[model samples]
Target: MSSAGVGCLYGVGVGPGDPELLTLKAVRVLKAAPIIFTPQATGSKDSLALMVARNYVDESRQRLIYASFVMGGTSDGVWSEAAERIAGYLLGGEDVAFLTQGDPLLYGSFMYVMVKVQAAHPTIPIEVVPGVTSITASASRAKMPLVSHGERLAVLPAMYGIDDLRDVLARNDTVVLMKVNRRAMAAVSQLEADGELSRCVFVRRATTPREQIAFSLREIAPEDIDYFSMLILSGKKGQV
Candidate 1:
């Protein structure tokens, strides 16, 4: 389904907060793409993806576009509309570089937009540029190895049930709890009850200037509740 001159869409993962962590391939795509698309959480004018890649983007020659989505979820046809707009650009023969905070295929808003775009324009070529994931960055920043020597590693959402989380801690050598939002305190409480809070490594804005890392739940402050945070539970030598 290749069109004569249809432009290829690029999903560029900007990396986890730290601009310097951005890959060379990602920077190249950002610089070459004519249109840059950044996702913004509803009610937030700032786009974290743009912030991370601002230094690399040729803002003077390139166009910047923001697509906002409700972090909780959206019933409105927001994704549909965004997809239409992106397809329109592609049909016009302009390459779009969709910037994402993390890897586009992993919990990135680009994933949703991707489904919509592909459904409408399957012929339009799309390339995903991989970047450093938050989980990997968190481990590196904390100097902790997530898994080694055939150890099991599991990642769960913050909204998972306490019973399920308990099972994860028991079954896996390392468990990562991603996107600790308003449930941050409750997650800590459950981990404390399960005696895994002590071994837990918590990080907010990993690899960024605002980064905060805590080894114990007791060390977490009230302001530490962030939707960008992640909790990693790993025992010594990668045994939970």
Candidate 2:
């Protein structure tokens, strides 16, 4: 729990889709926070991060704040507005926690809010608690090693065009493609063209109830994948 005199801001990663995967520190801070903020995608009723951490949240004691973040667009204004709302709580000397899925620093929207909050309130105490990333979770559930001794691993978002993905596939021993929603088939096609589809495994919503794994690209249709889907590509074939 934070001290009484000054309020603190905590950026907490609730881990990837699994409540049990949350760190002890994340639980502690979330419990202690008087106000909790979770990012809700525009048009979404609930935030995924909040859902992952709901078991640890005491709604009666903690005030829940939902901040709207528009996905796949310029979110500077959204982040700024969220920061402003959090700034008000900090000024009132209330400890606030912002919950995010996966690690706060890794492709999480919390980073955007963090920067803006820091810029607005430089003296406010802030801490970031790290959690298990989806990449590692997907790899673990698939029973595949992301990289071996001397093997290089590359992590990329599928939005980085097919040409760039092809170049990286040519250079790296292992690659993890994240944010693979509608682009799943395109990625599968690219891997197949490179003769690497056999070594690729597709995982969706790792560690969650809706978790799905496809060892062969043929088993995965683009329509079946969600925004949380990821593909782990290995240089060797028949690994899965």
The clash count of every prediction, one per candidate, is 0, 0
lDDT of each: 0.83, 0.84
TM-score of every candidate relative to the true structure: 0.91, 0.91
Candidate 1, lDDT over the whole model = 0.83
> After superposition, which runs of candidate 2 have C-alpha atoms over 4 Å from their true positions?
1-4, 236-240
How would you encode candidate 2's per-residue C-alpha lDDT over 17-118 as one tens digit per residue? 999999999999998899999998889888999999999899988999998877656788888999999988887889899999999999988899889888
Candidate 2's TM-score reads 0.91
| Model 2 alpha-carbon miss at residue 26, Å | 0.7
lDDT of 1 by residue, 30-136 (tens): 99999999888888869989999999988899999888887757624877788889999999899999999878888877887788889888888989999899999
Alpha-carbon RMSD of each model: 2.8, 2.9
